[model samples]
Target chain A: MEAWVRKLVTGCLLTLPVAASAVAASEQAVRVAVIGNSPPMSYVDESGKLTGFNVEMAHALCATMKIRCNLLPTSLDKVVDAVSAGEMDFAVVSLLATPERRKKVLFSKPYYRSLSIWLSKPSIKPGSPRTTVAVVNGSVQAQHAENQGWKTKRVTNHREISTSLVAGDADATVVPMLTAVSLMEKPSLQALGLESTVLSDPLISGDVCISIHPGRPELREQIDAALDEIKRDGRFDRINSQFLPFRLL
Target chain B: MFTTSRTPDNYRHKLGAGVLLCRLTAVFSIVFASAAAWLAVDQHALLENMEDLQSRTLPNSMEHQRLARNLEVLRLEGERVLAADNPENRRQALFIVTLMAGHPSLLANEKARNLAIETEIFLTRAAQGSRIDENIRDEWTRISRHLSLTADDISVDGINLAREDVRQMNGLVEQTRQKLHGAVALVLGFLALLLLLIRRMILRPLQQIDHALSDLRQPGSAVTLPNYSLRELASVREAIVQLHGLMQEHESTRDDLQKLAATDVLTSLNNRRHFMFLAESELTRAQRYGRPISIGLADLDHFKHINDIHGHAAGDLALKAFADIIRSTLRHSDIAGRYGGEEFAFVFPETTPQEAVALAERLRAHLDAWVIPLKNGGHIRLTTSIGIADASAQALEDALRLADEALYQAKASGRNRTIQAKTTQLPLPLGGHTDNSGHSA
Candidate 1:
């Protein structure tokens, strides 16, 4: 019996570090990215905490995967670069998984769809010298607008797009449907004579997938399975109903 | 139905062809109905999508089509601004362009929203006391035509989206067809499996039962019983087993009754009637095969005198001793029977007349030495007189008559002797114990 106990002790000692390392790996903090000022999609609350559809979805996905996540607020333009560079494990922001972006990063199954829209007043024509359409710098909409040879005033975030329109620096801005909805929610922006026109352009695929870190295909599969799990369990619908007026799925 | 070695207890539990067919029909019906329902639902969804495109997307495109038409008029108005046909044409052109630029399609298309927005701005500036110069006309013409092209592209995009929707509907139809084929294949496979089971469990067992019934008529041919899974077939097999047992019982009973009819109870030998039957048949076979055969009659010497001297019990004991001697002396081919009273008949097959005399002498000698014990401690020595005749060349009746005459001659000469009938008109003195000695009680 003494000899058996000694053998068991030796066996446990040999396997202890392997078990501990696995625990450590599971316990490691995964950095999740969120944009600063895309309301209802992701934005800072009054308490200076990031909380929105994307942040809540990230939390739910982490819960499904049973892992710890750290939501990091980043600029809208830097989400793709941060994830591709492995600085962030994944981003829950609404980024269209276009074919060009697939080369640099892996994408989960699309969580929702988006469309390009022009946010402006009905009387004031968009993209005038005085009413130049405001678009986020380094975004698909900005690229599409520049490629289409339209006059654009580049901004950094959704808040700036809304503010530049209200401040009279820009009279119109081409944004996604959700952001347009967000801006339209502000009666101040509406009272500022701002309206929205939804667009159907060939350049817009509208499929918003979770952009995962490049080279982490296993994590991508884990995220995809977790995403499907969340959708199946009604967590996705719950989040969609809480954040969006229209169904995302 | 098959009847073989099967348990009667739960044999009823096994599924028969009818039940199996019902279940197969149910499963097939369910599968067919499910496939139909699935396809119907998919077709309905496809139809609804097409309807959505027709009712919603198509009507929505009319708005864009109007926008395109409005842009063409705006471009013509820009041409009027460039023509300078009247000083008021510039203000009128600006008024027309501004109202047309406010159209939703102008702002909806990223490419054209800005072009129309900026053209409206330039026209406003020119209408506000600015000169309608070549640079202003050039800008107005360029922006208005570009916006017109952009409006046309937007309208066409709506139609292309509709075409894509129709293409997707086509894909759904193809997918539904594949599902239907899969369901059909599943149904066919299940039908084949059901048929195989019927052949194995039903048809094959029935065939084996049929073979067993046909084989039952041949004696000693083993009946190969079938193992039946179905209860009805098993009960049939059990009934067949009972029938086979009854046939065997009947055969054994027939054999027992025949034995009782032909055997003599007292002597454990054939009786006179059956003995005659056997003798006649043997004589016929001997004559046909050209084989020698003999007949003989033997009597105990002074059997009644023994009964008169020492009670009938001692006489019967003496007769039984004589029968024992006859039984011990006969060959396998020889037939012997008690022919009423003290007489016993014998048929010696494949035997010559001289051989018959030799065997009869041996029987007399065996009887002569035999002693019957009496209850009074008295012993009776017994003997028999035998008469033999060759029946190979004569009819059975003539042979018996000749043997009877020879027996009379032997009784005239003496008692306790064996005699051979004269078939060649001469006797070779074939009688044993034909001396002047008789029974001494």
Candidate 2:
């Protein structure tokens, strides 16, 4: 009887964590794409750790849904493809929805608008006809400039656009208004005053939305419901004000 | 009529088709600007969330989940240690347990960490061939439960933090949406108001001007422009007023030219053709109204003899003097003109033959007393013969012929005197009248 009791005790101890693993395996873990370069949305910080609005939001959403989040850093251009290919579950980045992207992936309701504006040297006139405008490669601003018949200088990102303008490699550049604002805060950039507060008026776009894999309409619905809850609870506002200098819906 | 000079003020103040469009664009721009500004701010906020997720929330959650996984591994390995039937398997399980025990990410809670340390020690002793008892087994079970509980607590904290971050982001998105909606509403309202103003102040006035111009195309139309309060619209009204005034002036100028064409250049009076026309018109009116009208003629006595003696220049002076005297003597109701050469004629409406004689006498007397001045410093006296005829039962042509005959009679009777022509059916007046041939002076 003592041997029987020992055997039962050993059986129970051995099964504890294995049993937990079995239960977890029955549930799929959420996969999230995080961009390590895009700031304010999702990026790697000075501490060399992945964090940002998108990353935090993804984690929080997973927590709200009672799922495990497996986050992976990805390139901006590849995020959609990764999500589409099911290599990643969802992507949180400074992504804009376009027809081509919509074909491959589903987008959540827009959460913010793209407030792009032009920055140029003070010596350069505002809206100089036919002047080359610099834009981030693979960005909506670049496409917009091209569509408007303005010559565009494509770079890697907003910072590179600013650098291109400063280096006189481009006549002017379009960046998110926030990026411009922050650039203006820098003394070096301020020295090169961008004459016009003229925004990308005609090109300003609608709200920014989340991108989900095409087959995951249910996931999108779940995320949307979570968003609705946060909105009603005023939690969204708090986080928005904490991260953004202005309010967006 | 309001007339303003074409200055920069007019151009500066002019409103046109673009104004309304500009207003709508401005409203839209403002709304879009507000939204853009908000988005920019939100982007910055999003950046901050990124930082929080990467640097804080995500890292903390990862650490917590990792520790939880480690604890699970340690729990499973502990089971392996308990179930080990061989020394080598027991040693392998003990090694893994020790690795988990020493992991830096292990739960910081003293109780959980202590439980892991205790499990590692028990397993190490088991690997060292220590005797196992019911008490040890029970102790192991209790420790395992505590370790799992502690890890669970830490993992839950991480998950909650992650959830809070997502809630925050979602909240921001909703807030942005609300802001954008409000901005759109404001823009729409402004655009509506601007459109209404444009319709009333700009389009309405333009339409009125269009209507006025159409009316002006009709004969004898009067231009009446509507009042406008807007500077540009008012300027348009002013332009229409000036145009209308210009049109009226042009009409007046045309009438003046017509008058000039009918006037005698030298005498500054109605020429012979106009006088004849007037005579005919007056005769028609008298016949229509049943009012008596008379025609008369006056001639300078021996006007050709004077021209032959004193030069044609003197004759011209005399002629001018006679015209002046006639003009001075005739009432405004009477019409007189240079009939031809030295002959002068008049038509008096509502006048009897007797009254015609009286008027002819007065004109003849004035002419007889007038002196002509010459450029050569010599003066000459001039006189006239007068003839009278009444319209009574006569056509205009007949009256003119009778007047001409009467003038001839006056010359025949005597120069410098008046005579009345006899009507075909009526006898001539005998009082103060003569039938003698008038001698040339």
Instruction: Please name the candidate that would achieve the greatest TM-score relative to the true structure.
Output: 1
CAPRI-style quality class for the chain A–B interface of candidate 2: incorrect
Task: Give the TM-score of each candidate.
Answer: 0.51, 0.42
| TM-score between candidate 2 and the true structure | 0.42
Cα lDDT of model 2 by residue, A19-75, tens digit? 999778756677888876655666567888777666777776777767777888876
lDDT of 2 by residue, B66-170 (tens): 567667778888988888775545544554575456544453546557777888887777655666678768877887787788779878977998899988988
Query: How many residue pairs clash (N, CA or C atoms closer than 3 angstroms) in each of the candidate models, in the order given?
Result: 3, 27
Model 1 spans with C-alpha error above 4 angstroms: A1-249, B1-156, B163-178, B185-189, B196-201, B218-229, B306-328, B372-379, B434-441
Error of 2 at B340 (Å): 0.6
DockQ of 1: 0.01
Q: Report the lDDT tens digits of candidate 1 across residue range B1-441.
A: 233445555566766657767877898788778878877888888889888776566545544554565556666766665565544445445444654465444555566667667776666676654467777767766776686777688679767767777888898889888988887887788779878977987788889889878877866566567767776777777777767766666777898888778877677678888898999999999999999999988877777888888988887777777777778888877999988777888999999878998998888877777667888987888766778898999888898887777776666667666678988455455445555445421
How much is B26 displaced in model 2, in angstroms? Answer: 14
- Superposition error at B163 for model 2 (Å): 4.5
The weakest ten consecutive residues by lDDT in model 2 chain B span B427-436
